[model samples]
Target chain A: MTQNRTLSLSGERFTAVYHIVCKPAEAEARARDICVEQTIEFPEALVTDASIRDQIVGQVLSLQAVGEARFEARIGYPVEAAGRELTQLINVLFGNISIKPGVRLVGFELPESLARQYRGPRFGQAGLRALVDVHDRPLLCTAIKPMGLSPVALADLAYRLALGGIHLIKDDHGLSDQTFCRYEERVRRCAEAVERANRETGQRCLYLPNVTAPAGEIASRARLAKDAGAGGLLFCPGLAGFDAMRALADDDALALPILSHPAFQGTFCVHPDAGLSHGVLFGQLNRLAGADATIFPSWGGRFSFTQAECRDLVAGATRPMGELRTIFPVPGGGMRLDRVAELSDFYGRDCILLIGGDLHAHGPDLIESCRRFVAQAG
Target chain B: MTQNRTLSLSGERFTAVYHIVCKPAEAEARARDICVEQTIEFPEALVTDASIRDQIVGQVLSLQAVGEARFEARIGYPVEAAGRELTQLINVLFGNISIKPGVRLVGFELPESLARQYRGPRFGQAGLRALVDVHDRPLLCTAIKPMGLSPVALADLAYRLALGGIHLIKDDHGLSDQTFCRYEERVRRCAEAVERANRETGQRCLYLPNVTAPAGEIASRARLAKDAGAGGLLFCPGLAGFDAMRALADDDALALPILSHPAFQGTFCVHPDAGLSHGVLFGQLNRLAGADATIFPSWGGRFSFTQAECRDLVAGATRPMGELRTIFPVPGGGMRLDRVAELSDFYGRDCILLIGGDLHAHGPDLIESCRRFVAQAG
Candidate 1:
């Protein structure tokens, strides 16, 4: 309902702040005009205080003029508790109007509601540390990937890896419902095999399936895997939108810990200053987004991430913010089994050690092979 | 099956040219093992041939090592017809894998097959010149947003904005699936309104609507709108994935021009020489991704892009690479109407200028109000 105050008056954001740049000083009024047209669809007189406008959107922060023809304006919104989190939020902030030439948004100041709902990591530093019983040692992990494998084929590998004492065994990000491996079928078979193996060998290996699709299908999929005896869900918040993680966290019944994957999340970590700081974005935001453990490319991996950047990522994932404990940083891609100690020393016990291909290299007799690797490392 | 030769025995990506960083030497073997594991899951003997891998995945120039733990990969695939259309190949290269992580592709090198498909503006450079017949003068555009509007309400505003000769009118990205204006109903009504306005004023103002959604639904929605007489479709490839845009371009039946939005895409643009250079990402890559026009946060908008970054975007959108002309750069976010002339001069007339809130502030009579604002600027 604040739409009236927002539209007609100079004090409201519909008129207050914008990085308006033009030769004529009339740009402010023009900018104000734009605010009404974009936010309310009508002038002050047409809208009312109780209208949805007051609730759906609000002013974030505004700057007068920083550059040439540009102004920075941040609009605020209550955090979405349901579907399509990041996508919906981004659209609300700047969507169709983004195509207009000569306008830019240089910064954003998130409201506490949105910030709180982001949920960062479902299990922070202490939580993940408690899960694997590894304190002050890099957490060990790996992926069963290259897709195209049958459920039994992948399960055999998972069972072996679990027996080897690897802390986590994630399905490859590509393991969607391709003819090679149906999602539910694969998760079911693999979970059973791991359970059986763990019973015999007394090793704890968690299986995290990559669950990403449209908003509606996500929670159901998570529930399906959990019901099928799976340990956790690997959530691609970037692909599914960050808020999806929070929704999972919000569910008391479906309280499976989440392992956040960087799939399609390059935009957040790719840019330095323009998007979010490493600590704020991956650390604070991912935790807010409800990630229990978050994965990223590490230094000395197949991907070219510098030590400082990797370190920053580690710090972000493990930093304490408010009541949230912080997330575990899992670094993978081209990691070798032998260097576990080095990576562990670098990231301390608050990290998830991800070794993808190295685990696969121990082929044929999966149990014996993985047992040696795990014994040598973790 | 070159999987073995290319991924295993070859080691270090030596047979191919992508030099992703490797430390302790053994990491290269692990990465190769991953390629071997992911591609030819059954045996190490397969997946060795680059050609076989191409058959399944597509062709590519090379995957390189960008900064530490980051990679700069260049993949080149045919444009379905061409001789190095920079635009088409980028689509075929990583369109499938971008959804997965452990991929930090920071750079690209396009070939001719891809170069030809990057058709900028569709009505770009010269074609748009003939439409409004404004030679060397900048064009003005505006947005219709805030959702919750009835189809009738939306159409009325579209009618007025179109009659004002604003050149373009786009829906703000948030106008999707809410109770207010559903996709088909709103598109049909808005298109009719724009057409009616054209009949009255003899002016053609284009309406671009955001059509980003789940996988199968995307193509259906695009075709639906095109059938309903839509001029172009708006998509944030960042949200829907690049494949969605490629799907639109490849559809000969639904050959509507596409305007790419930068909603969740700002994260990628915020980096400096990190994820992807803006020229390569928004311009060349978007062109490759099949966007007729690419929208970025203009330097002076509510976003953080500096002036040099904005101008670079213009060059990225318009500059030529082989036969494919550059895409049109539609800079936007918190833009005002009064600065049209300045923006026009900076970006040239081939662009679509966008303004939002300013037009509504004109007066009570929406149509007359729209006319006065457009008149004042020109």
Candidate 2:
């Protein structure tokens, strides 16, 4: 497990790199304060023991001034301190200090012992490609729209979209267990509809249901979706917690491709010099938590994510890290049919081009619109 | 149940208010787009049916131009649309729109039918006061510190804090199932030590262990804490989704008071006009998720929460909601013994004042320092 080597070498340390923007004079003190705030949040006097001070306390590795009032601080935390758990790792990385401004988590360097504990991406890009039987083209995915539609109506839309050649169809993140469209009913009808359409058209179309619910109901719902012939599961890790998504990915019974939808998560990445970077928050963290594919607002969309941030996100998903598999970055939110070729070229075949409302805009013929989207992408 | 009244009232609608900052000319268009983006996310033509439009589409209620390019918009959604679930409710409230900048969720008004589904705060201000038997005075809560401490050392600290008449001794949020101090061992020893100290001093001091873990282990850990004789559970709702905290709170077997800690959640409320308001995110939402006490960084701390926001949070906790009990507003993060009286006066009797590292600086004698803290607060 590499545990012996990690433990033997300077008390099992993992480096946490933070992008800090503060007065150059205060950068060193701020970096030290981060160490204390994240670890032994007590005064220096309380840390009576030498071992606690030397072994447990975070050590500042390097501080490089990037610009005026901006410095990048690299700090090392004892790997044993995080217990090799995602939740605790996040806590050790940015727990108490997240309350303070001007400290953004840019990257992390996990020791082999710590990184081995996580099971990242059960069905990554290749697995997902195999699931949908899409070989050499960017996959076309869309969301069943207009929340508050009855299960029957939504399933009807799913049937048409599947028949028209969209490879992956998922419930809009908004379509939860509402009264008008209950989760079980929606999953059952939509799955059957997609299956029926796939059989008729001789195409492989997957219906991914949103299984985000109360903590108790999440697993059961995932099980239900699997039993109902759903191809994959969609969840808002931001709302349901990243660990919840990891739990589903790690589960044997409901072992299906999981797609993470970004909802109520913008606050973390929206700020330039606070919170986390796009690559770390959306890409690396999502992949580490076992997302087969992650959905984000595309650049040139209504959101504020810049082109550079989008590129970084792509890099994060595809980058190599230990045994973690590379994941597909699905870009949506204001993605249109005409831009399918442009986005396909931009993201290449590894990406899933998600076009939502724009599919409906290409006339009342939803099937024709889907066909055009697939044809354009190919 | 008020289901009849809520259902009968013209489609059971609930209003979500947002504070938006944009160009003066774009205010009206932005408000309309929010309704579309949050609800349908489809082309206007696809919302062909009038009934679908009326029931599903978010209707803009009011838009007031507050300042130059700053406006407040109120939008209504069908209460049934949320399915009376916290996850869906949050999605319908924020969801895709959260990615858009300049739009901040200010407040929400849920219909009684929707509100009744949530069991907010199993033990509220009065219930907690009854639990600790400290009816007239503010509660004294201190976090057992220095993350690298073993279970035995932390238990000893808990014992000393309890002997000194501290009402609640909690593991610091950072002490989450780490190899240095495992969860079960720490809970067992600390709970026993606190119990022994209570017996010796004839007090009701309680030990609250941090039970935050992976998604699957949370409930079991809560059960373990209860079985170990711990008085309460501390979890970072932000790190381990809010629903996880709600699940622990809702569990009948482990009916201990649940404390919600703000670990990686500061970004949501730090911004003036980009994320959620302090009252809604920290107060109302935490209460809805059944946090007996919600801990946040207080004003005049290392964090940046304002005085007005703190007051708003208290009001959101204690204000009358349908059947939800009023929760305790725990003001923490750099709280001190000297300010106990001032904070007590500010928050009144129904508050928990958390003093962390400062308690140790008082003297080498931990018990005497705690005694002074308790005496000062009283």
Candidate 3:
């Protein structure tokens, strides 16, 4: 966060850095267009209120050419434009401008007055580590997958994984409330199974069910998961809006840990000259939205993210932002058992080591394989 | 939609057409990877359950070359996998696959059973036309913007626009609950102003307030707008999830027509080979999610959508899909008064002609400008 604090704000304005792809001659005008487009959204001459034009409209503080035919513009908007809500803040940041081509929101700087307003990560990396009682080493985690599995099969797998000393067992992101394995039934079965295994082995294991649902059902579903004795909840902010997760995380009654999944948000980081940077979306935005742990496609996996991008994402998650807590970076897209040592070295002890399919790939005895994973990662 | 029916379903399976950019030799393997990746999300060999593999796993039905090193693959999954929910359907459609590069969801075919389950557009093009009592011509629309304006100023603008016979007057997407003009005061004042003008002019002008808020507050705000005498609602499915709009549109109590705005969804259509097509996103998906009228960047607007893409989008909206009604395509975004005749000829009378700043730019008398716009468009 320190290194990426490229936005130098003067007064009560929050700055956003946009990567504008255009010719050198068009850079200043394009930057100005964004300044107006993001704020007033009216023609400059028509805005009769002088104070509104001066205070409310966005101002381009600085512009520099980053590459050939591409300039990075740092535009500042009044913090009042974002209001006090995360939704409005997001809209003010990248609402209408998202429709235009060649303008990518690379990074943003929210002043401490505004940044601290958001209650980010009720239970961050330390709180999660405390829950599992694994303080010094990377926490071992896995997802129960192959979506068509029934509640009984999934719960049985959950029991074995818990018994084998896995810290966290999450439902696969694809495992929504389908008829084959309904949400309530699956959460109850898996939570109870994990509890039973915890009692037997004296090792705490959490069963996190995916609670991504429609806007009307999402909050109620989170409450349902909590009532069903689930340890934590798996939320996809991309599917449900980011503020949905923030609301869940901020709720005192359902004060459970949230692990944000990047389900439909990949497009934000996939392109270089358009959309958002990987760090801004997966890291800063996730943490700002109250994710205790964030899962992204790690390097050397099925996804196309490079090691440098992964490192930047980790930094964005853990870096200091006023008083916000640092969350765990769970990088688990196509991660294997053999890569644990190397990943642990790369991410260090602060991350949650997530190995999904490879846990089942190691021989017929799933419990033994989990134990071996625990031993190897430990 | 008729011409782009590339998907051929069998039995109870709904098909999806994916544009996979890969080497010509690797197209088959890549198509197979999408099948396994989208559904099971595990190694194909490791999925031992024959029934699960047969019933739930995504299957590639056909693969063909579309362009230079680009292949179009139609993949099918059990209808039950969608789980009678829009959120689950979206998750199943693009969830984990969005993170993967070169895999774009171009089109999809939902069986009549699956399509009918979704409440597409309660008040579609016909219903909206009935509301305004203007069935013969394009409904002229304008947005009251310059985000920092007070509620009184905005209300005055709304009044003039309504009095001048603009069919729809909506709050600019930028005009959220900012401190200058909170949502409550703004919606109430604007709605009352529009109603007052409607009373004077003996017309059915509708005031549409932008109710795009945090997930929990969206429905409540929509209800508040209805209670305040607002004739319709403007929602951004991109900011709030698509299902949010569906939830609002489907709610019987709030039976206001919804206009879907493309706020943060530009990234999905910006890339040709990475995300969804303009038609699939703005048209078919919006209508499926219950938007009565979909607002997108017109071809000649400040945005970069071409005439071809705009035409495709219109087709996706209006084309017959089982028993679903057609939605109005409101082509806007920097649209001017001078282009009204050309746009009308382009989009036909079924579309809503939205001109924002140009009306204000015409003269000091906004009502006169609105009257001129109505006369010209009419």
Candidate 4:
């Protein structure tokens, strides 16, 4: 597939592919408008010099009309224009154009220089597998549920899940620093409970607390979780900025495997021709932001993500991309224990199967349910 | 007129209203599911005690069928559930539920106790008006554009715009700390030029530099802009987290008014029945996060926002609320100088009219164009 056309630019440049749905007659004009909008956002006369036009302005590489009102426009931006920053790269990709309708960001072809700048996934699939000592099968994960539960109650649940051989136990994204369960107390108790369970069961079970908080408090909260002996961290990169997760992953003091949660990120992938492709938003972007495992609404779940989209996401996570490590695609949201075999076969061994509410449906025996979940995945 | 339905058993509870478009037969089930998904994401048996059910669980206040397959569901949560934090409040309102389709967050009825906790808009509409000394007329604002320009060129542009009596001069959200124009050098030079222009013209023209950066560097950049004598700050809250803006607003050291640039936020407001309402996402949320002025693509512009949606946004920004100050709705994106009269008449006096690329098209003289813009708004 000839996805991108080479632009004759002097310096390092990266290609950005967008799925534009507009009138076929207007496709060419719209493509030019995007190139101008993403760069100058001003009139043509503002380009005082030709070098600015050649170097700084985005160049349209290709424009192919796929459907009646659908065109795939590939534009190339100078690498220097991005300044090698993730936020700036995103701005260059779809910043102002996002406000305009009918433009959807589908894919990115980062130059080696630009792609290597981002330290993608500190502890990726292999590292996580090594950490949990679960190499031959899909990792079993679940959320410690019932938001109003006390720190003690949640810790007890974590302990039971750990003893039952779940590889990763994460906090429900709703579990923030609420009065009912303060962050520090909850982290300490949950970490201790998981450690106790690990000691008894002779297994490396990890407790990942949701550290999404006010920007200033996020680092401190992560530090506190680490000090409390928590194994990993779960972040809602959608609610908090994706860069926050990258910062935590890069932090030397609290170097733990990070899991990206898709809480408020649905808007990006929900629309067919507006925001971003499921593979790019849920898979590539999350991996680029240093998410060891990226969680999304699985197909046949409560959410509306399709099976094809989920397959694309898996491909995006494990695609060959320079030195960036492949991360785990944690399919979650309304996943059931009964579907464990099917999910494992579908996603293969390089995935994390997250089963939530259905774990409690088998009876009041949480431990037995979790064991059943682990066995089914195996 | 009555937007909220009071919950019978409530102590300082807040109401969250969602516009749900689902099958009439499934409206009740979907509403109940939302109440569960937003709060617990667990099964019913997880609610061990009645107190837990009453306090922790979200209660449906009212469900009114609006259309054949549309229903308005209002759910109430205890104010304490949010922990008096903006991030937590968002999580409580729509975290896990964002992935679910046919649900849109329309309105939030925050109690005084909850609303007052956020230091919303340090310099709100009145405060900004007082700062710029513009009364009985809409404020004139424009972005200093042509992204590849040098710092000196940008400073010259800022000087020309300030001399023309433009109230607010903001960096095009695309202008970040790039090699062409470093953040500190651009901010310092622009602040000096604006100050020099202000001194000569005897006008209070504020220069707001775009301080959107990596999570850790945001505060330092904000501090640099303030220390460089920049009058206010421009933040892309969509790219950076909203909490980052709130932290800057709440920072005692840098108390400058913030103007939020709607760069990557359009995804949430574009879809009608998926993400968020025009008023809630762009207006109420921006005010809550401490944007003294919020910028969005104006109606009939290059963007797809409608006039009615713009009106709703204005109302959401300026409407009476509990202690949260009213913010200015700065409408930009393809606004032409010729439409100043029509826009002014439609948006009324409480708006910041942003005229961008058109200012450059009128003539080579930017100052003269800005003067004409100011005169037209008047």
Candidate 5:
């Protein structure tokens, strides 16, 4: 089997998702029975009312179908679990839950015949080199506004930051579809502002926006962001699904890189001897899922990840991929400007450096403000 | 705020969903950049990619994108942040990867309100009492088979168990959409055999089939199971998303009690500190989600939860719900007939005693098999 992105659709298991529509009143029973038949992957099953009414059998999680003809359903089963060695890739396409209604398996893909698939990180090490016209050394990144900033206010910040030589500028997680600024409008204006600054300063900076939603509607937004002239879009794959990140990686029309966030994902890393290690979770998994750069809370930050964990994350990001590209690890969160050289020493050059609220408290000439970070860190 | 299950929509915060389709090739890139944008929350405001990619925005975390097209997409923003938040809701639907040509947002439902919509275990306490004919005491349950049991073999076991007075009988999670035990055939025979046993013993034992799949096709399957004379269904809300499970509870037409299973959900409990607590995750959440009975890995067994966690889980299950029914917690995973007394003592008489493989390892007489558990447990 080729370990490249261009995987053979045959043999590898496939999954097809479908969303069914039904009266809200009947959603739970419907979802349960469908999933049992699909994923339990067994036979002669019997469930009793004692089980249902007492939640002995069906454990309902959301009440979305509270007053509508909607219910979310999912069935997952291994393709070749037993005698069902494999057949019409379509039929077995995640046959686990295919029959359940109101559960449309939107993210469909072919799994490797073996345990793994793509090597991931398409433009990893060398590719990124070609993109930013950089052969070596690290990268830099900063945020625009955390809250309550107009689009122009954000763009003005983008211009000064871009001119001052920051590599990328993005909105804070809290900057989502808020009344203060809209996604399409803000992204468009910021990209333009960055482009204008690039023309004068001759530095290339990318503009990215946050995009995270339910199960549908991610594609058009990417297109919209692209049309608006933004460099890329950002998302929380854990909240959405890692497959969503995989999807973004495969779309060229959107033609931008993806950055993974750790919001709501801390639970997975907070435990030791349990859950994926930080390197494996934020670094390798994100890379495998096609992250260009994976972010983690740095040492001496408000968050609790240790310096060792941060270092391991960087190593995992830059490590080898079989016939795939390498990923860059972005270590940020509660960083101090005075420690710019320390961060550089710890992460080296091929990293995206992030600075948040501290940027503002450093004296307001925005340009002069950022130039200081560059002088000390660079 | 009225709690109407029919046609009422109410929520404190406006929640919308987005769905995006990938162009197949640029999937990874689109995935990576999206992460950067959302997490960094619009970095173009102050950083230059070259400088950051090469030098200053100094922080942590990095990103990379893929060149695959057929990827997934979705974005979530506050209702106040989006225009006609409901209109753009489609963008974040189907998980953001179902909006393009090849994919589709199969199913979704955003609760009109977020103030605890689901009231789990519809008839959790009282409902199950009415069905079983045995009020106020614990419910005894025993699984039917291991992986290699034939249909006739399983049928015989079901018949004996039902006649022996086991209140609930369910298929192992390992059984599913497989050739070994086809769903329809197994369900038909089991229901019939249990019926035959009921006639002879005058004991009405309800059969619970594991019904798990994507939400879309669940209605029909549920209808099929209900019509098939099966008593109820089983489901896994973790893998399929908790919302899918709640959808099942609202299903009164086939009003089978829902039994929540813990398969891929160990993570939620395994991380003692970070993830949800055993009591909250299993008890409160499941109760709120509508699980009449939830199956969890019992302590002093194969799984890792401690004795306190297990006890807390039971407490969570049966705790008082102001207007809703209390759920039964089914502690399983490697329990045996020998522990029936201990389990009963620990959980009291209101729980569903679940023992799987141990039943198989017991002397093969199905009648004696279930008799041992019920007699000893009670």
Candidate 6:
């Protein structure tokens, strides 16, 4: 079982922090196993290449007891293992280890070389503000919904919402290219309606169509949205891969801001002790994958996310990460018009205030309701 | 908030079974909430259109007590809601509800029209058996491993494994286009090496290269593998979106048998009362999304999958689903040669027996170990 060659150890390494839930005696062993499992995926004893053992296998930089029967271990892996791609970086981060229980990836620190390789967030917080011509207050955003609505009805709603000064109006993540409202017709009518409203009101309201489609059609669908005058794009990185979102962001031809929606991604963060933390998935990862704004369930909503978790999520979105621009943390999910002031005070102007169904509560004249929402949000 | 129009509902519908964990008093409310949350996403009180309520919004078909504080709820949604795409089907199935706790998607039943829409496995069990010309026994598969290995070293291993009578030799999922072994070079050399071995041995051994690259590079890389004479393709539907795998499976140009690797997909199945059941994620979903063979961590392995869970996974893979062909249930992850008989009895001949690191144990003489694995497996 002897190898003929010794591969060079790539010097640059990235660190990942994991919270391992185990007994005091099992902590060290579990940490060591994670190091081996994430990297080589082979028996360490038989790895005859000493350099492979020393350099390639994950190095446990530090480990400490965080809570009863839980230990936080910081492990470093060579940047080469990531293959200098976001997809592979994620694979190296949590691939096979995700199947195992009690190993939650809390946070990570990538080397400068790897961080620079990804083109994150084309139109981040400042860029989004520039697009909407609003810098003083939180950007007011809404989703056009009730799945069975015809394209014309959806367009009418978009027109009114745009006239009322909503900065970013996006399609509901559930509104794919369904038969009731096909993607092309819906995007075209909404974009035109929003544009007509923008012309009348002198507001730079952006219509973000949900371009999340099948893999083959995603890029073409995005191009169609852009050609149809879509102001931005709403993508579900959880449903379509994170790399798909990154690819969308990095495409210079389709240079529209991207708003990431949390659809199938909830499994990664819902579990406290097994999957990722809320901040890591919705905040850091979303920004790194090139989302201009990332949407998640806000606290006090119908969803179960707590206030502390929401705060952590906000921090992760706005935190400094090399040269990557800070993305807007758009919090929605059962948000209300009455809570607009309280949310504004807590989230500050860097956030996008997303109120969906509640906008209808102030309706009859939906435009007037949106205007009231804007005034209250400010 | 009244709509101007009522859209028609296509009669064909799909039923999704969810395991809802809540207090006895809250079970009905939670089940109803899921139906609304998964479909229209708007507040039900505001959904004034009665036909929209009756047709488009998910309808709870039945609810039954499953366990303590756990109830099984079968909810049906119009097939039109799925948008005739695998990606949208998943979005409609788990999308927003993934964020909510206590909702586990355990099973689903799609209408014949919807099932017929997807191009499932191009090379199913029978097709795969024909390709290898082996029908009487369980197929033997091994992964070339140790992340730092060069293309030459990997090809050498492939040559030996092929000579020793293994049916399939796939690149370790970790062996993406790393600088140590770029995908093009690795695929070319390994394909040539395996072909040379087949010439001498007169046994059909498929060298499946790991074609899981970043979104932009995946199709090109898959084409390169096929052009270079690789026998099959290995993909991580979880890493690259499941629809990406489906796209590859459906593509007329680069049509190769795809082996689905469970890398980043573990989160969907790990939680006991949340996420998806092992059968749904690994078996049914994989087949629906066009995976010819689905690899999972077997019970008694380094991973935490139990024997019961593995059996459920096998059932999910081979169960009758409209016109969709049955796929191979590959159980790997630290599987050993000694357990071949037990696994063979349990999984039956329709499965692919994947033994990774253990193949090196009877080694020094690697080919001999593979031969012994084949003999024991048969």
The lDDT leader among the candidates is 6
TM-score (C-alpha, index-matched) for candidate 5: 0.60
Alpha carbon lDDT at B103, candidate 5: 28
User: Compared with the true structure, what per-residue lDDT tens digits does model 6 show for residues A1-378?
Assistant: 535367785678999999999999999889999888888899999888888888789988999999999999999999999987888889888998999999998888887888899779998999999998998889999999889888998999999999988999999888988878889999999999999999999999999999888888899999999999999999998888999999999999999999999999888888888888887899889988999998999988999899888988987898878788999999899999999888998898889999999999765889889989989987
Kindly list the per-residue Cα lDDT of model 5 for residues A213-299, writing each as its tens digit: 433455667778788777766766655445456667766566577777765455445544333456656765577566677767788
- lDDT digits (tens) for residues B109-222 of candidate 1: 444433443443455545544555555555566667555556677777777788877776777666654434567888898888888888898876777776775443567778
- Chain A TM-score per model, please list them: 0.72, 0.96, 0.95, 0.96, 0.70, 0.98
* Backbone clash count for every predicted candidate, in the order shown: 86, 1, 0, 0, 224, 1
As for model 5, its CA RMSD to the true structure in angstroms is 16.9
Off by over 4 Å in 2: A1-10, B1-10
Q: DockQ of every model listed?
A: 0.11, 0.52, 0.45, 0.45, 0.05, 0.76
Root-mean-square deviation of every model: 9.4, 3.9, 5.5, 4.7, 16.9, 1.1
* Model 3: per-residue Cα lDDT over A175-252, one tens digit each: 988777788888999999999999999988999999888777888888988998999999999988898899999999
The candidate, 2 or 4, that scores higher on DockQ is 2
Could you tell me the TM-score of candidate 4?
0.96
Q: Show where candidate 3 strays beyond 4 Å.
A: A1-11, B1-11
Best by DockQ: 6
Candidate 5 chain B has its poorest 10 consecutive residues by lDDT at B1-10
Candidate 5 - CAPRI tier? Answer: incorrect
Q: What lDDT does the true structure give each of the candidates? A: 0.58, 0.86, 0.87, 0.86, 0.57, 0.90
Task: Please give the TM-score for the first chain of candidate 1.
Answer: 0.72
TM per model? 0.60, 0.96, 0.96, 0.96, 0.60, 0.99
lDDT of 2 at B269: 73
Residues A1-378, model 4: lDDT tens digits: 011122234477888889898888889989999889888888766566666777778888999987778999999988877875677888888888888878998888888988988988998999999999998889989998777777888888899889999999999888889777888999999999999999999999999999999998999999999999999999998888888888998897888999899888888878787888888887788888899999999998888888898998888888876688999999998899889888988899889999988987888888999989988988
User: How do the residues B275-355 of candidate 5 rate in per-residue lDDT, one tens digit apiece?
Assistant: 445776677656766788888878776455689888878777765545557888887766878888888888887888887
Kept native contacts, fraction for each prediction: 0.14, 0.72, 0.64, 0.59, 0.07, 0.74
DockQ winner between 2 and 6, please give it.
Answer: 6
Q: Please identify model 6 stretches exceeding 4 Å from their true place.
A: A1-4
RMSD, candidate 3, Å: 5.5
Residue pair clashes in candidate 4: none
lDDT of 1 at A100: 33
